[model samples]
Each structure stands twice: as C-alpha cells, then as structure tokens.
Target: MALLHRAELRPTKLDLLAAWLPSRRWFHGPAGADIVRVAGFRFDDPAGAVGIETMLVRAGDGSVHQVPLTYRGAPLEGADGWLVGTTDHSVLGPRWVYDGCGDPVYAAALAAAVLAGTGQAEEFFEVDGERKYREPSMTIASSGAGDAPVPAVGPPRRVVDADPALIVTDSVELVVLRCLDDGGGERAGAMLTGTWPGQPTPLPLAYAVPR
Candidate 1:
C-alpha cells in the first residue's frame, strides 16, 4: 500500500519552501518575503516509502503560514504539470513535488487513510453550535477512484446549542469525534483527529479545514 519514507531526508525546511510556496495559489507574499523556517513534522506513508511533511514558516513580516508537501524519489513522468519543482539529489536528490491533491501516490495513500478511517481536520461551526464540513478544494491525483464520500452529521443544527460529532468516510469509516472547541476568530473552532489505514495520524489541528 503506497507509503512515504521518513528517514535520512536531505532537503531542509527552507529548501522545501523555496521550491514550494511560490507555486501555490493561496500563498500571499510579495515574492520577496524571505521565508524563515519555524517548525515542521514528517508523516510516514503506510507503505513506508513516500514522505509527507507539514511545515510552518514565517515570512519577513512575521506572518506564519503552513505548507504541506509530499516528496518522491524519481520523476512522476507526464505528471510534471502537477509538480511545483524538481531537482537532482545532491545528497540523495532527484525529487519531485507530489501534489497531495493530484499526485497518484499521495492520492491513493490519502484515500486509503480516509478509508481506513483515519484522517481528520477542523472546521468552523456556526454560532448556534453547528459544524459544517466541506470538501477540500484540492484534488487527489491518481488513477484510483474518485474522492471518498464525506458523511454528513444530519441536517444543519445550531452551532452554539448543539453538541455534535464529526465523522468522515469513503465507502468505509475514517474518523469520528465529538465537539472539541467553540467557534472563535472569524470562524468557529472545531478540530478533527483520526488515523489513516496505513499512515500516521495527521495533526487535525495543524491546518484549518480548507474552506
């Protein structure tokens, strides 16, 4: 089952950002906001070969942003259109940007994780204590099947008054959880947590559920 390796990786977090952030549509910077490495973590693919990382970086203005990246050994030919960058391994180089949404390796791994019942993220609920989960805007690239269905929690309820639970699935169960936090900021505060079939559990709080 396709997996990511998490050992002896060479690229420093900054190297990753220099090659990644500029390629994303959501990256808000003047193209000169020098990136300062902050913190990051690696997740092992269930197959134990591919590597997924969630990195936090601060720009020159002290703005912090999260960058989620996937790495692969050889080039994923014909998939260059989906990649952000590629370079030879100076120290085991020869890596390619595996778009989590479109890269087949990552797509299947994520699907398996979701199907295995382990992949969760947080979303903002309304003020009445209701949580609404939306499908991510990103697409997983793979010759595999389409996206797994995200289960609904019944009709929309009051965000502040109801004590609801969050669940996700893809023909099989993925994650289930009760209320974690109240709505705050410009949105509600609902965190998601679960484990994938063969991969490490992603930190649900690491990313705000993509709107």
Candidate 2:
C-alpha cells in the first residue's frame, strides 16, 4: 500500500492555497490578488495515504474565508464525482484534487475528525459585523443508499455568530444553505446550497423558502 511521506519538505499550507484559491468559485479576485494564510490545520486518514487540510485565508482586501481541501498521493478511481481539479505539483509533478465530502478517504477522515471533536468551528461571524445579512449553519448528514433526499432537520437558525464544528450524522445527508435576517431581527430567508463534491463551478440551488 502507498503511504504519505512524513517530512518537512512538504509544502506549507499557504503555498498550497496560493496555487488553489484562484480556482474556486467563491474567490472574488483575479489571480494576482495576494492571499495570506491566517490559520490552518491538518487531518490524517487512518491508512496514512490521504491528508486533509482546513485553511482560513484573508485576501489582499482583508476578506476572510474558509477552505477545506484534501491531498492524496495518487488518483482515486470511482471518485470522479468528487474531483475538483488536477494540476502539476510544481514540486511533486502531478496532483489530483477531490471533494472532501464525497471521496471515501476524505469522508472517513472528516467524519472521524468531527467525531473526535477536532474539526469543529468554534465561532462564526459576519463580515464587518453586519446585522442585516448573515450566513447559515452547515451540517453534514449521511444517507444509507448514497442517494437519499435530505430531510429538514429543524427550523433555520441564526449562524451569523455561531462557530459550528463540522457535524457527521449516520442518517442525514449534508445540507448547505444561507440564512438572511428579516427586518424583525429573526432569520427570514433560506437558500439551498447544492451538493457538488468535486464540481469546480457549483451553483447554489434556487431560493425555495418563503420570504
């Protein structure tokens, strides 16, 4: 079996981000914008062949965002559904990017991290302390058949200031959404963020909840 090398020669987290950020849909700037790594941490697969990293980055304009990524030594077949991108390694020669949510290796690692209490976010906040708008809380639920519809777990709650840890449930499929605060200081909008796994240009599902 192949194994991940353990050595300092591995590129720093920022180095990987510098090469990756430009390719994301949420990235708002041109390729030349400077990116600074504010914080980063790694997650390891049990077999030692895959490594996952969650990075917090601040762009030149000082916008902060979170990026979750997985790195593998070789391509994982049957994982096309989760592929994000493949590129020359600059140092390692060739590399493949997989969506951490679908790739089994990454999924297992992520689930373990969440269960172990290692990958949860401690706090969340809005940009510039804005109160009129806010982001939604994200949750990952599992399906038995791998193609089950996501159930409405609960009423939409405020995530404008929640630092939620990534959650992995045995029965729930993952759900991503955005919550907007109504004029009454309560959440009023629910917008679904679809599952893409490795899709590079993912589009959000149309807003479905009542305004």
Candidate 3:
C-alpha cells in the first residue's frame, strides 16, 4: 500500500520533471513546452525504503512520455550522472531523486514485479485521519509467464546507447521504455506494461535480459 501525504513539496515533481525531461534522449517535446502529469503508477519497495513511481506525462502537443523515478533519503553515490535534482519533502525531509532506470533498487523491484506478474501498488490517501483506497490513474500488467526468477542485482553500472534505454546491472541488462508507443516492444520477450487511462491495451514499460 502506498500512502500519500497532503504536504506541499518545494520544486514540485512536475517542475523538476519539466527541466529534466528535455535532457533525456527519448524526450521529443519542444523547448519550454507545457507538460502535465496525465497518469501514474507505483511499486512498493519490499524493504520499505525507497519510493518507486512511474509517471506518464503529456506535452502540450499531445506527446506522451514515461518517467520512472526513485526517491531516496541520501544521495546515491556514483549516481551523479543519473541525478535529476533534489527537493524538500514536507514530511520526508530532504529527498534525492534519480531516474529509476539507473537505480538498482528500482531495477530489482521492477524485475520482481515483472517476474511475479504483479500490478501497481495500491494507493491510499489520508482524509481527516481516515485512510481511503483510491484507484490509480493507470493499470499495469506484466506480460509473459515463466518460472525463471529475476536475478538479484546491485547498483546499475552503466546505461547503453540504445533505443529502449538499457541499464547494466549485476546480473542482467534492464530495458526501460522511455517513450509511449502503441505497445509493441518485446525485445526480451517479457516486460512490465501499463495501460493508458480508460484504455485496455497494455503499453510496454520495461523489459530484462541476461547480461
């Protein structure tokens, strides 16, 4: 379960993404385009340490992009190149945000979810001290079935210069879908997928392959 606080954040998430999104190779938006968070989903850190979220944002020209982000208490050493920015959370104090594609925690969590065929984390909001489950903006589905366990991995060593963003981990290479296409990516034959709000077709989110 994911509990969302009603606290304000300095340099709100959208603002941070606005500046950082254009830096990605997959970003197709024009400079200074209006970007809005259209949908999102989350994965729980089995250890309850980091916040793993995937946001689907739409540009003013109707192009959609997928951003996987991780929030940590301390800076991820050796991840300077992957750092998006830092922000202050009213309830969580300071946060170090990074692209999940480069974070090991995110890679492992995503691998587990895909291998286990799990969906997004259940969301809950606090209203007058009452907890209420709120439906997420999108639904995710892990495609492919197999008993092969997802290999455990350490910090991402590096990213490859490929169309589907690839992250080199300890045991495998993680492929993250940087853009929202019509859901036809299957390089690894298995992937984590998400559906657009009100849509039934699943779009590829990421995949994995042996290193």
Candidate 4:
C-alpha cells in the first residue's frame, strides 16, 4: 500500500510540470499554457522510500499527457538531466523530483507491472493518528498473467524523447506513452493499461519488450 500525507507542497506538482513539460520533445501543448491534472495512480516502492506516482494532465488544447515521477529526499546521482525540479513538502521537507524514466526504481516497477501483472498500489492517507482509505483516481491493469515472472530491471541506459518515451534498460525496453490516445498501442505486446473518470475504456499506458 502507498501511504499519503495531507500536506502542502510549494510550487505544486502542476507548477513543476508547467516549467518542465515544454522541454520535452513530445509535449504538444503551448509553452506556459495552463495544465490541469485529470487523474493519477501510484505504485508502491517495496522499500517504502521513493514516492512513485503517474499523473494525467490535460493541456490547453484538451490534449492529455502522462507524466511519471519519483519523489526523493536527496538528488539522484548522475540524473541531472532528468531532474524535474525541487519542491518543499510541508511534512516531508525538501524533495528532489525527477522524471521516472531515468529512475531505476521506476523501471523495476514498470517491468513488474507489465511482466507480472501487478497493478497500482492501494492508498491510505494518515489523518491525525489514524489511516484513512482513499480511492484511487485511476486504475491500471496488465496484459500479462497475474502469476507471470518478471525479469530484473536496471537503470535506464538511454531515454529517447519521443511521443512515447522509451527507456532502454539492460534487460528490457520500456515504452511509456506521453500522449494519451483512447486507443493507443492496440497491437502492442505485454503492456500496462489504465482507465480514468472520463476514459472508462482501458488505454495503453506503457509496455515492455525483452532484449
């Protein structure tokens, strides 16, 4: 399960994206345009250290984009290019945010979700001294069998900036869709698909191919 804190964030998530999104080669919206977060889901880090979240945001032109990010207390070594910027969390203090494509933890989680069919993490918010269950804004599933075995994934060797960003690891190549089309990647192999409020039909979010 993923634990949540009801705290304030300086230069909120959307603010960070507004500055970082236009730098992406795949970003279709105008620079400095308003970004509205539509939905999101989380994946638990087994070690419970980094925060893994995937957000769906709509651009000014009604185009939706998927952004995966990891929140950490310290900067990730050798990931200066992937840094999304820093934010001060009310409870967690300073956080170093990075695009998940360059994070090894995210690669491993994506591989597990696609190859083993593990879905989004169940969430609970700590309210006062008790834990309160919260429904996820989005849901995800995989084409692989639930009991399928997942291969070990390492840090990305290369990240291609494209409409569907590609993360090439030692064991697998992961394709993460930046643009959210209702019928994205219909003929893809093992993949992770998601459904949100307006989009009830599952659409491909990411996929993995063994090297």
Candidate 5:
C-alpha cells in the first residue's frame, strides 16, 4: 500500500514538473503556463526502494500529457541527466525525483506489472489506528506477453530510448510510452494501460514486447 503524507513538500511536485516540463519535447506550453494535474496512479516498488507514480497533466492549451516519476531517498547513481531535481519533504526529510524512464526501479516495476498482469495498487491511509483505502483517480492494468507469459520480472541491463521499445532485460524489451496513445500496437507482447477518471476506455501507458 502507498502511504499519503499530509506534510508539506519544500518545492512541491507541481513546481518541479513545471520547471522540467518546459524542457521536454512532448510538452507544448510556455514555461509559465499553469499546469493542472488531472489524474494519476502509482505502481508498486516491491522492495520499497523507490516511489513510483504517473501523473496526467493538462497544459495551458488543454493538451494532456503523461509523466512517469520516481522518488528516491538519495540521488540515483549514474542518473544525473535524468534527475528532475531534489526537494525537502516534511515527512520523508528529503527526496530525489526523476523522469522514471531512466530509472531502473521504475523499469523493473513496469516489467513486473506488465508481465504479471497486475493492476494499480489501492491507496491506503492510516486513520485513527485503522487503514482506510481510497479509490484512485485512474485505473491501471497490465497483461502477460503472448504464449510465453513471462514467469518473472528481470532486472534491466540498460534503457535505450528509441520509442516503442526502451528497456533491455533478460526477459523482454519494455516499451515506454511518454504520452498515452490508444491508436495501435494491438500486437505488443504486454502493456500497462490506464483509464483516466471519467473516461470509459483505457490507453496504453507502457508495453513489453519481444526483444
């Protein structure tokens, strides 16, 4: 279960995204444009080493964009280029945030969810010594590859970004979809999909196809 903190974050998630979004090719907006977070969901990191999240944001022009993020306790080794920035968390003390595509933790979690046919983890909060679950704004799903049906999640050796397929692991090639697309790829080995709040249909979020 993912825990929600009631404390304040020094720079804030929106602030970091606002600064980083302007630098990405997919983001179409002025640097000062007001970004509204529409919907999001979290993927579990089995070891709890990193906090994985994906947010769907509306740009100034009302265009929707999907951003996958990973929060870590310390700076990720050999990931300086992918660092979004670090912020002081009132609850966790400090956190290092990244773009997620380059994060091994996020990659592994994506692979596991895609091949294991799991869905988004339910969010829970501790209230008066009891755990209460709250439905997320979006629903996420994943499915196994074709007939082989991956037996396990393998650690990735590297992530070579070239669209459609990104991560190279012992098992399969994981695809990272920066912007949610629903057009094609009906033949992908496995995929992680999500349905935005109030949306009846799901879109491909990530995928795992044969290497």
Candidate 6:
C-alpha cells in the first residue's frame, strides 16, 4: 500500500515537468508547453524508501506523454543528468525528483511487476492522522505468466531517452512507452498495460525483455 499525505507541493509536479519535458529528445510537444496530469499509477517500493509514480500528462496542444518519476529525500548519486528538478514538500520537506528511467529502484520495481505479474499499489490518503482509501486514476496489469520467476535487476548499464525510453540493466531491458497512441504499442515480451479515463481499451505502458 502507498500512503500519501494531504500536503502542498511547491512548483507542483506538472510545473516541474513543463520545464523538463522539452529537453527530452523524445518529447514532441512545444517547448515550455503547459502540462496537465491526466492519469497516473504507482508501484510500491518494497522497502518503502522511494516514491514511484507514472503519470500521463496532456500538453497544451493535446498531445499526451508518459512520464515516470521517482521521489527521493536526497539526490541520487551519479544521476545528475537525469534529475528533473527539486521541489519542497509541505509535509515531507525537500524532495529530489528524477526520471525514473535512470533510477535502479524504479527499474527493479518495474521488472518485478512485469515479470511477476504484479499490479499497481493500493493507495491511501492521510489527513489529520486518519487514513482514507483513494481510488487510483488508472489501473494496470501485466501480461507475464503468473508463475514466472523474476530475475534480480541491477543498476542500469545504459539509459536511452526516446519515444520508448530504454533502461538496460543486467537482467532485462525495460521499455517505457513515452507517448500514448490509439494503436497501442507492439508487444515485445512480458509487459504492463493500463487503462484510464477516456481509454477503455488497455494501452501498453511498458515492457521487459531478457538481457
């Protein structure tokens, strides 16, 4: 389960993305375009130290892009290039946000989800010390065999930012779809697909193939 606090965020997530997305080679939207969060889901960190979230955002021109982000209390070592920006969280204090593609925690969590057929985390909102269940903006499922075994994912040996961002680890190659297309993406191997508002049909989000 994922616990969220009812707190404010300085330069909210979208604001940070608006300035960061244009720099990515795979981002086709206008530079500095306004971005609005359309939908998203989260994967729990087994150790509960990192915050993992994947967001679908619509640009000013109606183009939708997928952005996977990870939040940390401190900067990730040797990941200066992948740093999205820093933001102040009311309850959590300072947060270091980075593109999840370059974070090993995200790579491992994603690989586990796809290879082990796990789903998104159950979310809860905490307000005044009380916890309330919150419905996820989107839902996801994996095409992997339920009984399949998942290999331990190591640090990313390489990260390529493209239409489908690639995270090449020692055990598998993780493909994260950067754009949302009606045609969906071609299946590669074990993959995770999601459905959100206005999209009744499941769309490919990410996939994993053995290294």
Residue-by-residue lDDT tens digits, candidate 6, 1-211: 9999888999899989988988877776766567988999999999999999999998777667889999999999999999999999999999999999999999999998888877888999987779999999998888894746798899999999787888999889999899886444586788788889999898888899977
User: Sort by lDDT, best first: what order?
Assistant: 6, 4, 3, 5, 2, 1
Q: How high a TM-score does candidate 6 get?
A: 0.95
lDDT of 3 at 142: 73
lDDT of 2 by residue, 1-211 (tens): 1222323333454555666656655454445777775544455555655656555466676444555566766887766645656655554556676645445554444433322323322233233443232222332222122223333222122211111112233432222221111111222222222222232232332121211
Model 2 alpha-carbon miss at residue 157, Å: 25
Any residue pairs clashing in model 5, and if so which?
none
What are the per-model C-alpha RMSD values against the true structure?
15.4, 14.3, 1.9, 1.4, 2.5, 1.3
lDDT of 1: 0.41
- Which regions of candidate 3 deviate over 4 angstroms? 182-184
TM-score between candidate 3 and the true structure: 0.91
Count of backbone collisions within predicted model 1: 27
Q: lDDT of candidate 6? A: 0.88
Q: Which stretches of candidate 6 lie over 4 Å from their true place?
A: 182-184
lDDT of 5 by residue, 95-159 (tens): 99998888877777777678776567678877877888878898877766344555454556776
lDDT at 69, model 1: 58
How close to the true structure is residue 193 of candidate 5, measured as C-alpha lDDT? 77
lDDT of each: 0.41, 0.41, 0.80, 0.88, 0.75, 0.88
- Number of clashing pairs per prediction, in order: 27, 8, 0, 0, 0, 0
Evaluated at residue 161, the lDDT of candidate 6 is: 78
Query: What's the C-alpha lDDT at position 50 in model 6?
Result: 98
Ranking by TM-score: 6, 4, 3, 5, 1, 2
